[model samples]
Target: MPTSSRSSEGGTRRAAAAALLTPGLLALGVSFVVPLVWLARMSLNRTVGPAELQPDVSLSSYVDVLTDGFMWEVAWHTLWLGVLVTVLAVAVSYPIALFLARTRSRLRGLLMALAIAPLLTSSVVRTFGWLILLSDDGIVNSALSTLGIIGEPLTLTNNVTGVVIALVEIMMPYAILAMIAGFGRVSKDLEDAAGSLGAGRLRCFVRITFPLSLPGVLTGALMVFVLTVSAFITPRLMGGGRVFVIATEIYDQATTTLDWPRASALAVLLLLLFGVFLVLYQRLFRMVEGR
Candidate 1:
């Protein structure tokens, strides 16, 4: 082919790729970039009163958010929620994901659906359901009492414990799906070969299968952590307003107090936290791939 023709073809392909990407880029800008920029600008403004803001630009909002002990507590609560829920969800989903990944039964599809069935319901509905279940006199406490597992009803609601439990359930399906994808690359043949070499089931799983599935585990953990950090519904309902998180704080600042600048500052902090985690995730991914 002539050099000019080759160059022309390359340019055409580049143009086609750029055209295809334009809509997605535009959507992303409208949905994410523009709002982020707006928030950053808003964060720099001064809050004059509820539902009122001043046009003056300053770092007072960010300074207040950073210096406020309450803000730190909320941030701690948010991080704690994210870590607990992510750990619990990933732990609970691991075996289920492994079973689904290895199973050859006719009901595999049904089983997979069942595993993820909770996702079909709205989070609000599910959170309400949790409210019923975790209430002091609710089914969980009643069952525990009846079974003699406890002498009295546990204080499960309006606390971090209840929120963690509910968030774990809400986040499990995501963790399971990520793990299932991770397990796809973990070959059963490797396990069988290890067994043939006189490795016990647990040994084979620990030495061979687990390492291969770490990518999924890491992916699921990262995803659940991020979701949990930003989650509002389950925490609000299950925590019964006793648990204050960054999300709830932001909501209250934005809506109740109408302190848009403060709310925007908190949001920017949350975004920074997410960026830090993403950087850590990339590093971890590199390490995993290196191994």
Candidate 2:
């Protein structure tokens, strides 16, 4: 073929590739970008209902969200829950992940299956399990009664603590998968080398294994934190309508109160915070990866 003909065919292929990307890019913009933009616009809109003909876009939503003591309290509650869940899940999963990584038995699949089985259960189902167990006349109470650990049942449900317990159960599986991936990627040769150099098990783990697994732990923690932050069913069921987080607040504002502007504003606020966290995580990850 002539040089010009070959060049023309190459350019035609490039054009076709760009054309194929256009639809995907357009869909992404419509589904994600457009909604984000609309939420941002609504955040600035203060219209309450059909009464207002023209909604003025301003900083009122942000001002309202920031000034409200209730929202701040709710935000604090959510963050505390996220942090507690992340810490506890990491603590619990560390050993289990290590066990899974080290074990080579046929039953290892069964053990790993147990961790993943909870994930297969719906969020509602998992929370409901906690609800049944934590109730005054439930299995936990029965076991305690039978064991004489306590004379009476404990009040475990209808509180933030109850909600946290359920959240941890569901979130821990996700954290485990992340840790397993991380630990699996780590070369055991390093650990063996450290051990041969006179390091004890604890030292090898702390100095080599733990440091190398930091990326996994960090990513897993972040994933658990974000999921717990947005999770609504567990909190709604276990909190007994007494506790409110940002997600629950969004639900209440949009559904119960029929406040679109407020809901959108709250959503925008959440997205802003999420963006801040993502940026922070990226920077922190870079530092860790550099090490």
TM-score of every prediction relative to native: 0.95, 0.88
Predicted model with the maximum lDDT: 1
Summarize candidate 1's per-residue lDDT along 1-291 as a digit string, tens digits.
699999999999999999999999999999999999999999999987779889878999999899999889889878987988898999999999989989999999999999999999999999889889989899999999999999978999999888888899999999999888877668979999999999998999899998888888988899899999999988888888889999999999999999999999999999999999999988997777567
Candidate 2 structure quality by residue, lDDT tens digits, 65-182: 7899999999998888889999998888888887887787989999999977887879998898999999889998889989999997888899987898888888888999988886
- Looking at model 2, residue 129 earns an lDDT score of 91
Q: Candidate 2: misplaced stretches above 4 Å?
A: 1-27, 48-54, 107-111
lDDT at residue 184 of model 2 (Cα atoms): 51
Query: Number of backbone collisions per candidate, in order?
Result: 0, 0
Candidate 1 Cα misplacement greater than 4 A, ranges: none
- Against the true structure, candidate 1 reaches a TM-score of 0.95
